[model samples]
Target: MAGVLTGVVGALLTLLLHGAQHVVFGAGGHSFAQEVRLASPPRRLIGMTVAGAVIGLGWWQLRVRMRVIRVRDALGDPPVRLPLRSTTLDAIAQIIAVGAGASLGREGAPRQVAAAVAEVLCARLGLDDRHRRLLLGAAAGAGLAAVYNAPVAGVLFAAEVVLGTLDYIAVCAAALMSCIAVVVAWPVVGRDAVYHLGAHATAPNVWVWVVLAGPVCTVAGIGFNRLMEAARRGGPSRAIHLLPLRITAAMAAVGLVAMTLPGVTGNGKSVLEALVGRGGLPAGVLFALLVAKPLLTAACLRGGLTGGLITPSMATGGALGALVALGLGHDQGGLSMVVCAMVGAAAMLATTQHAPIMAGAFMLEVSQAPPTLWLPVALSVAGAWATPRLATGLKQL
Candidate 1:
């Protein structure tokens, strides 16, 4: 029951996201980045500025009225009951912000909404705290599955990240919820992979390259995570009365940046797609994105924005991978740019999220990469996951 409701709400959230994008950026059938690229400079500037004003005022009002409990806090030991109304409103605001060119991921909104729905249902059913936690975690994962059509990744996310458990019962529940949500969402969201990759044979020596590159990607991922933490810490406080004006100015600055680099606007999906697609960006542009995307994303968070880091992290990783491929002379013919980017994405994602299996499954499910690439991806993810811990241990020693 929770799964079904979450799927429905998740699909509605997806529609709302698309509608917001269309309304904000005049995005007709194309991706958000493309629409931003196609828009006139004035339009880009005006659109983001207006969006920032509206979001700032709206969130200011909402935050002043009630304390918003994050999904993580709601899922704590006692399992606090989520306020459905506030959570739904928060989700809508997040969607609007992202649609209007915020450098944050849209996945967080659906997860929050789904968890709220599960909380409501648990109350009505009088479920125990344990059962409620399990259902809430599953629902959150199901929401991710619905949006991306990734059941396996959803299950892994629930078990590894949300619940922090690998118990057989929890895994089974997560799998069932994720599978149902994906099936339910197929009609509205489509069943195709979220990303399309061109046909490119894997380079024979890709494994060797991945083994060497994984640690580098992990270091980059660690840096990205620290930057985000710093941004969150330094962001404007809710007590500020001038939040709306401040946010508007910050978003305007983002618009100015987007005027030249439209790819930095959205959650970074289009950037990732471009990286893995045929005729990827030039080496210089890739390097620029590797530096700019994360910095811009961190800036948004510092400006009081709230959203997921998954896609942004993946995109940054893709840029790093592409750059590494170029540096290692694999871009010529040895390793395809597509494969290198995927390895980088997986490694970075694993490092940032601290979940190797989930990260690998997500990259594979979203890209529909062939099974032959699995071993190399696993090795890369393992290296990424282990490197930071080893470094920490060495420091302690």
Candidate 2:
């Protein structure tokens, strides 16, 4: 009874907090997009200056918790402190940075928030480790659900990535919390929808596309996937350490890239939306953005930017897929490619998180598009095929 009650309370708190998170996150995304696109010449320069400073400061402060904070190890590892305080502060700060035009996503930030909340509560209550772990998973599910309004995704995320497997009790609690979160986020983000719809088809028309989708996307993206592995496993490689100084030199080189192609520096939703029909810049500009966005994202992470790799993958996959679509089928091709990018987001994320069903489910819930759930399932599972091989660092299950 007590455990159930605690779980219920934790779930409710997560639901409520998620309401605030959604409104703030949506407003942040909306405002950040506008801030990026406005006519001001110095806007990006200012954003980067602020982002660089914030990242430097945030990382330094994070160092204090270094003794206690094992970011890479904490993937499925035990909690080191109370969950609520640390995760909530992290979430709030991350949302602020992302909303202000820093190229980070809200997904991982909320995981830390919800985990901290559950951990602290479980500790105070003297719950056993297993029960506390379950509670922690429930809280994570709720926060993720709130962000994307995807209940199944939330539950599966907790099970696959957080808990390493599903527990019947955990699933029930996650479901309840996820329901509360989706309901809470609806009014704040306005339940209209997040994804733009194109003409709905029953399935992919080409056997070739179907066969190619997995291989092409997997390959087109596998190098970046390797980059993520490199990023996670990187820092100082002794003899090879200063050699990466070449990357820093690459960063200073971007100062020139910025002179003409500034849009590549931050999150690329503005560019993604532009591909939808605005055509503010020519397709060539969009192509330049495709090249510049990924390189810069890698550069930023390599260059000391803070945050997850979700949005950067989304920017590249979406725009590149759109460009592919334009070449093959124009708008339809572009739209298909855009959908491909969305699938890539789920796929690449699945690779990183090692949670294909979870990632696929997340795609379904967060996207307003109808039941193309099969695509995500295929992409996610395929993307995760190498998880066992690639499961170094945070992905080691």
By lDDT, who's the top model here? 1
- Model 1 scores a TM of 0.95
Q: What are the per-model numbers of colliding residue pairs?
A: 0, 7
lDDT of 1 at 333: 24
Model 1 C-alpha lDDT versus the unseen true structure? 0.84
TM agreement with the true structure for every prediction: 0.95, 0.73
Give stretches of model 2 more than 4 Å off: 1-31, 65-79, 82-87, 199-207, 232-268, 271-283, 332-338, 372-397
lDDT of 1 at 115: 90
| Span of ten consecutive residues with least summed lDDT in model 2 | 235-244
Per-residue lDDT tens digits of candidate 2, residues 111-202?
A: 56566656667777998767876777777666666665566787887677766766688788777766766665565544544454444332
Candidate 1 residue runs with Cα over 4 Å from true position: 77-79, 236-238, 330-335, 392-397
Clashing residue pairs for model 2: 83-116, 83-117, 84-116, 84-117, 87-113, 325-333, 325-334
Error of 2 at 240 (Å): 20
Error of 2 at 228 (Å): 2.5
lDDT of 1 by residue, 1-397 (tens): 7778778877887888888778767865567767777788888888899999999899888888877888899888564678999999989988888888888888899899989998989899998999889989998888888888999999999999999999998999999988888888777888887888875556666656689657887888889999999988866564457778867876787788888777788788888888776457778788778888898889888877788899999999988877777776665322377788888999999988889999999999998888877877888898987787888999999
